[model samples]
Target: MSPRDRALPDEPDESGAASGPAGARPGAHPSAGLSDLSIDLTAHEMLRRAHVLEALGPDWDPVAALRDEEAAHDLLYSGLDAEQRRMYDELVAAGVLPRRGGGHAAA
Candidate 1:
């Protein structure tokens, strides 16, 4: 390899090392591995449970419940780095505010 080539940084293509299922060109989205789109079931279940709890208002304390939701969001982002954690928190906070209704929901 030429010295200049060695010194020059290598730029990753737009596909970024991704490839489709059939060993096709990385540019082909159809061949992207299924694992890349995998969902974390535990996190999914936790969020679902939180939603159910939110819907079951009479049985849960509003402040405490929001805390639990925050914690769950925290747990979900535990695998992420610092910047990712902030982004996750931002997403969670966006939906965490209480809904406005003039009076309590009808029984």
Candidate 2:
């Protein structure tokens, strides 16, 4: 399901205001309840990891990084909260990852 499929009740609808409080009225927080516009710690970490991964020269290998299962798990799981961890686990279990044995896919 899309991120919109999972939204908090208190979240805003579309605009920039919040759902309520802080002088926010209903439908005021257009940005609220919108996970697509939100950014959490996990998202930040994933972007950072992507940058690091990209920095690895094309000629250089990704085996070391991918084979370090513990580190990979830790890196990916580090900033995730309970719900995020659950989603990550679900994704892994569902084989959303392109590689087997938790290693990076061969290019």
Candidate 3:
């Protein structure tokens, strides 16, 4: 039978008790038979998350955020001390970093 045609094993009653599957004990927890991996979000929590995304607005650019992160990284690593430059050169020689202009690694 198609999945939709099959009856659910445990349906909730009006009072939120489980009218459970065959061989299940009466008045067992509503989620007794469910997987622990599932997430249960209340209506208010779902609406809060929706509002947070909506507040980010249509002009929000994930790419711009990435570019800003890259800029910050560059600013932080722009000038390396002599010891740092030596370690960077060693990393490049070890194939950990790609070689860049003037034997420096890209920030």
TM-score of each: 0.24, 0.26, 0.38
Tens digit per residue, CA lDDT, model 3, 1-107: 45556555675333334455644566687666666686677988989988988999989898999889768756755788888878988987888865655667443
Residue runs of model 2 more than 4 Å from their true location after superposition = 1-73, 98-107
User: On residues 1-107, what C-alpha lDDT tens digit does candidate 1 reach at each position?
Assistant: 45544433475433434433445555567635445566669988999999997788766688897889867744644477667656645655576533223211112
Root-mean-square deviation of every model: 18.7, 20.7, 13.7
Candidate-wise lDDT, in order: 0.56, 0.60, 0.70
Tens digits of per-residue lDDT, candidate 2, 1-107, equal 36667546886544434335555446566555445555569988999989987897577666775668756755765676777757766776787843344533212
* Backbone clashes under 3 angstroms, per model: 3, 9, 0
- Report residue 84 deviation for candidate 1 (angstroms): 5.9
Q: Which number leads on TM-score?
A: 3
List pairs with backbone clashes in candidate 2: 11-33, 12-32, 12-33, 13-30, 14-30, 14-31, 15-30, 15-31, 17-29
